[model samples]
Target chain A: MIKKFTSALNLKSGHVDLSHGGGGRAMTQLIDELFIKHFDNDLLRQHNDQALFSVPAGRLAISTDGHVISPLFFPGGDIGSLAVHGTLNDVAMSGARPLYLAAGFILEEGLPLADLERIVISMAAASKAAGTPIVTGDTKVVERGKGDGVFITTTGVGIVPEGVNISGNRASPGCAILISGSIGDHGVAIMAGRENLQFETSIVSDSAALHGLVADLVAVAPAAIRCLRDPTRGGLATTLNELAKQSGVGMAIAEDRIPVKAQVKAACEILGLDPLYVANEGKLVCVCEASAAETLLAVMQQHPLGRDAAIIGEVIDDPHGFVQMATTFGGRRIVDWPVGEQLPRIC
Target chain B: MIKKFTSALNLKSGHVDLSHGGGGRAMTQLIDELFIKHFDNDLLRQHNDQALFSVPAGRLAISTDGHVISPLFFPGGDIGSLAVHGTLNDVAMSGARPLYLAAGFILEEGLPLADLERIVISMAAASKAAGTPIVTGDTKVVERGKGDGVFITTTGVGIVPEGVNISGNRASPGCAILISGSIGDHGVAIMAGRENLQFETSIVSDSAALHGLVADLVAVAPAAIRCLRDPTRGGLATTLNELAKQSGVGMAIAEDRIPVKAQVKAACEILGLDPLYVANEGKLVCVCEASAAETLLAVMQQHPLGRDAAIIGEVIDDPHGFVQMATTFGGRRIVDWPVGEQLPRIC
Candidate 1:
């Protein structure tokens, strides 16, 4: 017989006060409606203070991310869904099967209860869709004016299949570089939502979990794939530069080969930002042997999340560790790391 | 052969701007001097874009914590150490062997480089002592005034021994309760350090890792132990109340049996605060079978970190799940959950 300890809560129209984050009845209600509803699974349904589960035999990959972006509700998603996707993508970058997550929230005093519920619901939905459950969590409240609305920190655990030796340093010369989707969508979307940067057109953030796409790629070209990286905060340019430095190689690309949506490109130009440096939360950079590049690209394109996949560049042995792209005008220039953050509070 | 990457930074000491948190030379230097230097380990030295390590085969427990304590540096430890200890304790509470950690930093613009260095050193020391290393991390900087000086979020992963089942809901009727060391030391220590309090006393915050003591308890009384909890934010009274609610049981605690240091008790009395609601970073609450209570108490007292350990309470089946304490005057009163945060950022 199943015994339900906590009752369902009416989360709509509720405003979160200091008490909500205070580990009392208010917290229990929030967990029941917003967290448990979406992440509902046997492990979480147990209602124990901690989640207990067994891991199948394999190497494990664990990653954590904290989401404190201002304006809890953004164009694409709220802090809740972002928390699930951020850590899930982190584990997925290791070519692993993300299984479970632990979340800790530091909610500021006086945040509307409705907003918290909305965020939590979104998080639950995201976790459910991604096949990961938030089994254990903690809630803490900070004094009024001492914190932003709410900050969520998520820790994810995943299992990597045996014999999958993948790392940023594993990229070898002649490996093909492919991007899962268009660049700069997430950063531009967030900036557009900001009051100061309100633009004419709406641009939603490309925030998502990429484990499914990764699992598909690994199935087809496991040995050929050298590395996988989700181009986040610093974007594709910074990611490629880091990979170049790590692998002791250089990268050459044709500007025409990279995919950039028209709206994103125009937004970047208007804001004086390079599309390459802007973030891409849903997109991933995969480095694979040239022999298996087409197979991986085909698999990525078949997935709805990776429909805009493109073969962007190729790796080359270069001690200088340069990342260069050829312009449509037939000229070439070095793509250096961005001097500073392109957009702040972009996950 | 070993390689060294150290340089004298050109920027002035106290003038950090938006670019410092950018993933570039300044950020690299900040990580190299402040974070990497203190959190040095072979896994971090891999210098790959991510940290990779081997996990032993076993059940796993994972936890994450976001440290947003104001005045980044506190009485006994700063946000760095607090971040490490907070998550590590969460993992240890599951009766697991804590192994690795990942840290994320949200740095506000204009934070002094020197201060970051101090916090990083504290984190390094805490990790070294706990036998866990921060293997991977991400850093972001918010504009000045938009955020406090620094916020640290740490995530930890651990391996649970087979057949070890420890949880908050495991408390049963006739279970004995044990507390580690003096309570309210951390809360009072911070209160004394506050400029508004203006009370001068020699009460240092009890901010130490409890995994060592947990290992000791598990060694001698593994099967008898039901639950282990760190009395952190809402302190002993709140923690006991949570246990009671989770386990659907009532608790009877002796007020005189609960250990409180002279300084903490005096400070609480002077401030019109209850030491029961005050925080204690280094202390923990253990629940076990009543028959093995004496043996567990003896084992806890033998450890340096648990010298003041005492059996403070017992569990009873109750419909209302009340936590009542017997006063020294032979009167019994209900200890209710705290309504609001008594002292913010006391952790």
Candidate 2:
């Protein structure tokens, strides 16, 4: 049956029309040929509206993210990978190991089947690499001119391990802050692609699944870790501000220690954007006890995804709960949250 | 802080811009004054990327649905209620009691704040009424001309009680098929609103949450019920065909026994559309043992959402798995799945 449907689909040249998402034979064919073929799993084989499974006994963490990145395809990643990585990272930020994902796609009429297939393949690869299968999904099509190419919304569920309690409000005075790697790669890559901007060096998006890295960190120091956050949409500055406000603590970061690629810094300068506010898909900000900062940094630096991990700052006591950064030239300034978004649809 | 942010929002006159979904202060303001204000709960107040909660030990069912209904507002319900009901029904089809919902919104720039507020209020009301709180959500904005007004994708998680094993493939040769109520109201309401068509009587959508009704039916015949499906996008004909194929059996329906409202029938006739293929937001098709069919129908009819419930069909042994219907005109015909959607974006 699957072979018959696959043969009917002109995978190389056909385009998605209204019928592909019409909840009829065309829609079923597309799911069977494209989605089910790539994201095959036991639970999804049931072909039910929902997936039924057993969850381990523990606190569960569920997160949702909508990916509307334009151009669908980027240098190192596309909207598909970003959708999977973003939601999985969100679930990971809660100090949990992501278990499964549910994807919802809103496709525009007349989209090329080739492009959609590529995106689905990428999503399946990301899910497979992360060990989290996309167990269920729904698709809807809008008329031409009413929608962009494709907008994917992914929701993930994870199980929080015992003895692990992480939240934004767990940051406290004297806690050390660490960043996984250099930032601004993802934002700069997306901006360059959307605006057709060229640079000396092409900056690829840092989009990746971080659950494995997070698990490694938690294993080393579960009790010492205070909080874990992925600096995504609002970037490092806004993330720190949120943490400070939630924890009622001030933050002081040294600019020289924060990791930022030279090319990325140059690109942000050319675009007149602050790297502090640029998004990073594969980066994380870790808040932990000062005593465990060096050991945690060592463990993070050994991981492939966190080679450039650095201890960037420390928490402090301040009534205003301000996030201040020490400039490279010995100046200090408040790294406040941007009033408006510096980049929209970068994810 | 929340009060200060609320004062800053001109809720009556403001329009959403790209910044509102930019994950910055503007986005935070919108969330604080609008979404958080209405869907206020302790889990959301934590303001973490993911919500953490405890679930009972049992089989878990997770479902996702993307709602792209045209004309954000219709005669009976808006996109918000439809989003909630659609996801909840999908979970309930697995005989699960839905517990939590996660919403992700893709908003087009320049959408009126007032309209967004109304939609959010409706979602909150629906969630509250259904006893399912939307624990976490994400919002992203697309540039004007890149998206329609607003598209919402909701994912729900539920727990299936012990001794209940419901699936589409569980239907057997002797099972009887039942429908909850009149069909085609939702699709007709949407089509009329989009095309500016009028009828003698207003055709309002039957968009509603049916988990309570499903629970009532499940309680009466837990073991006797074979399968449950809500005829949403492809309506009764498509739904029956899907069930037949899944169960590897044939279905025979009496068209006259299927309930269709007078206004809905008239509207479909004028539009040259079939009621069997039109969408229904708040209806279900149940396949149960013949012995329990009468009892299930009685229980369903007592519920407000299923007052017009009727036994319309039965499953039969056939290798071909065809769905044949006895037409009102006394002719028998194969009720095949539509090749394409009759009404696009009808939810």
Candidate 3:
């Protein structure tokens, strides 16, 4: 009955009603036709409310993230893909190979069924690309106005290989700072698309999972890499400030060396915003030994996702724990923590 | 600096503002005075933006929850305690011993410092009660109108012991069903206290961490226990239906055997709600072998949190996955999965 309804139903254009989230025939059809169809995997095939699986040998790292981004569907990605990538990256940041994921959804009443299907399909695509299957999950509905369109919370489990020691607190003096690509694209894109804030030129969000890129870096420069961070909510400035406090160290960056697209810079200028503090979905900030800087850069550049990799700065010893950047015009100033949120729901 | 401001801040009768969520002097003051003071611990003592810790050997279970209740402070528990307890119980439901928690706060602009302090203190109290320390956390602020006062997200990690296999799919025919205590307290309390809903009777939410109760149960009835679940959002009826489907079995329950307070029954009757489908913050549903039912009930009844524990039903072989309840009047009817969300955002 469920298979028949889902197969014949127009999943994309339909809106969800009270019955969709009620755990009755409507919900069963939605799950069987939409969620189960897209998120198909061996573990999910068991049809159990909870998933059971074995882990690989080594130290394990676990991380969970909740996705409450407004406009659930965005240019580069939607809430579904972001949930998978955000959590997978968090677990991978610990130098772990992400093994599996569990997703929990809180759907607002009256959400479009088509939108839900789109998001779930995207999630399935991202998981397959990243080679991690979503093993278990839950779904519940909140009344309209009580919740945003949809909120997804994903939990990830992974195993770190032997002899790998990576932490935000591990950055030290003499470590070189490298960024995977241009920053602020995600923040600008979301802002422009959301508030209808326009720019002379259009830009897209940089939301992608960087675990594969991190794996490549670790395979070659494991010992040289002291720390890795995704410049997310607080963007580059906030992330660096966090790293400084974590390692009890200071940092010095050349503004000209940091990668920022001209369009994004222009958008920030027009909106009276700071690109340095903007969010980036796909980029990473790497802290590695100065000696292996070039080698690491070379490796990162070879990957399609890291073609714009650049040496943005270097670690420094400062008892005051400040992060300073030399301006492109040769003026120096402190790049402190953000005074307030740059974009409220950028994530 | 942060310590002084947090101590003086009153969460009750206060509103949030821009500075509270910002990372400026005011934000620092808020963190130092409120969050740091209530969440004092060695890991948090380091005062880094993120926390680092080590875990003991065993398979790990991780869960995360976001609390955005309408009223920040509610009867029996506030958002702060709910944030901690919700995630801790989620981890515990997997039969794991919860170890640590990480919290993230999203304070709206114009929120009072005192209100923040109260919530933080409550969070501290709940964490301490569960014997778990909040190791790391992040804070961000949004504009006043953009947010609904305050939102909290907590992530929890726990270690599962070896040789213990428990899941929703483990239910078998002839298995006995037991409930920890009374139900519908949380849902009814929230409803009565709601701004628009006015009711004469008073009820308190049963918000609590169940790790202690679980520890006692594990000590005596580990092997016989087939499934353990916390009836939160969809309440007992939804949870039972899920178990039946997952375990590929049927259930026979006694409506009179299920515990429901008079006030709760009245509230449900007036509102045309079913008490069985109402949420319970501090209750759990346990399914175990018939032989271990008495032992588990005795162990549960001895605990203060489980004083009203009772055997409500038994598992039966039925591929149709029906959950039938025999009423006090000797009539039997299907107690199916809920038709809709009885009370949204009850979690």
Q: Interface RMSD of every candidate?
A: 3.3, 1.5, 4.4
State the lDDT of candidate 1 residue by residue for A1-347, as single tens digits. 11223545545555567666555456556666666676777666555545667776568777777676756777898788898999899888888889898887877777777777778879988998898988877777776666677878787888887667778888889999999999998888888878898897577889999999999998887788899998887789988887887788899988999999999999999999999989878999999999999999999999999899999999988788888999889999999877666766776
Q: Clash number for every model?
A: 5, 0, 25
Highest TM-score: which candidate?
2
Which of the CAPRI classes, incorrect, acceptable, medium or high, describes model 2?
medium
What TM-score describes the B chain of model 1?
0.95
Candidate 2 clash pair list: none
Off by over 4 Å in 2: A1-7, B1-7
DockQ of each: 0.42, 0.75, 0.25
For model 1, residues B1-347, the per-residue Cα lDDT tens digits are 11123455533476567766666555656666666777987666554445556666668777766777655776788888888888888789888878899887877788887787778889988998999999887777777765677778787878888767898888999999999888999888878777788687888888888888889888887888898998877789888987887788889999999999888888899999999989888888999999989998998899998999999989987878889999999999999878545767665
lDDT of each: 0.80, 0.90, 0.78
Error of 2 at B90 (Å): 0.5
Residue-level lDDT tens digits of model 2 in B1-347: 22224257887999989998888888888887888889888888788999998987778999999999989999899999999999999999999999999999999999999999999999999999999999999999999988888999999999998888899899899899999999999989888888566555588899999999989988888989889999988888888888887788999999999999998898888989999999999999999999999999999999999999999989999788888999989999998888668978888
Whichever of 1 and 3 has more lDDT, that candidate is 1
Candidate 2 chain B least-lDDT 10 residues: B1-10
Q: After superposition, how far is residue B131 of candidate 3 from its true place, in Å?
A: 1.9
Predicted complex 2: DockQ: 0.75
Q: Sort by TM-score, best first: what order?
A: 2, 1, 3
CA lDDT of B301 in candidate 3? 99
